[model samples]
Target: MAHKLTRLVPVFAVDDIERLCAFYEKSLGFVQDFRYGEPTYYVGLVKDVVEIHLISTSSPNARQPWGSGYLSLLVDQVDDLYRRLKGFDAEIVVLPDEGITAYAIL
Candidate 1:
C-alpha cells in the first residue's frame, strides 16, 4: 500500500493541560475546538489550518518524548506575532536578526 501523509497535529504533553490550553488561547489566538474533562484533553484551532492538541502528563501514553523536530510557520508579518507573543509571556527562543524573520520554539 502506498503511504500517504495527511495532516500533522503536534500533541504536547503538558504538566497542566488546562493552563497550556489557556496559554495557547490567550497568547497565540487559538480557539478552543473541543475539550474533554475540563480541558484535561483539548484541541485548539488557529486560522482554521493549524491544530494543537494538549494532553495531560498523567495520560496513559504521556511519557513519550516528542523527538527532535521543528515546525516552522511562514507568516508575512513575524514582528506582529512577536509583539503579540511578548505580551503573553511566550518565550522567544529565536529572535529575528535584521530581516524580520523570527521563530517561536514550542
Candidate 2:
C-alpha cells in the first residue's frame, strides 16, 4: 500500500509572526485561519486554494537567506493582484509584464 499525500502548506520562519500575518491579510487578502501558542508561535492563513503557515523565530539568522524561501502564488487576476501589491508599497522584484514576482518586508 502507498500513502497518499493531502494538502501542502508552506511555512515561513519570520521574526515577527503578527506582522507577517498582517501583511498577508492586508496586502494579499489572505485570511487568518488559525494561530497557535500563547505568544503566537505559529499561524495559518488561507486565500482561495492556497494556504500558508508562519512560525515565529527569535533569531533572524534562522530565517532563509535573502532571495530564498520564495513562494509562487497563482491569482485569478494577475494584473489586479500586481496593482494591489504595488499599492501596498510592496517591493516588486519582477514586473507583471515581465512575469510578476513580488517581495515585501514589513
Question: In terms of TM-score, which candidate is strongest?
Answer: 2
lDDT of 2 by residue, 1-106 (tens): 9989899998888888887888899998899999887767888999998999888886433465477667888657777777787788887775644563443333
Query: In terms of lDDT, which candidate is strongest?
Result: 2
Residue 92's lDDT in candidate 2? 76
Give the TM-scores of the predictions, in the order they appear. 0.77, 0.79
The TM-score that candidate 1 achieves is 0.77
**Model 1: C-alpha RMSD to truth?**
2.5
Question: How many Å off is the CA of 48 in candidate 2?
Answer: 1.4
Alpha-carbon lDDT of model 1: 0.73
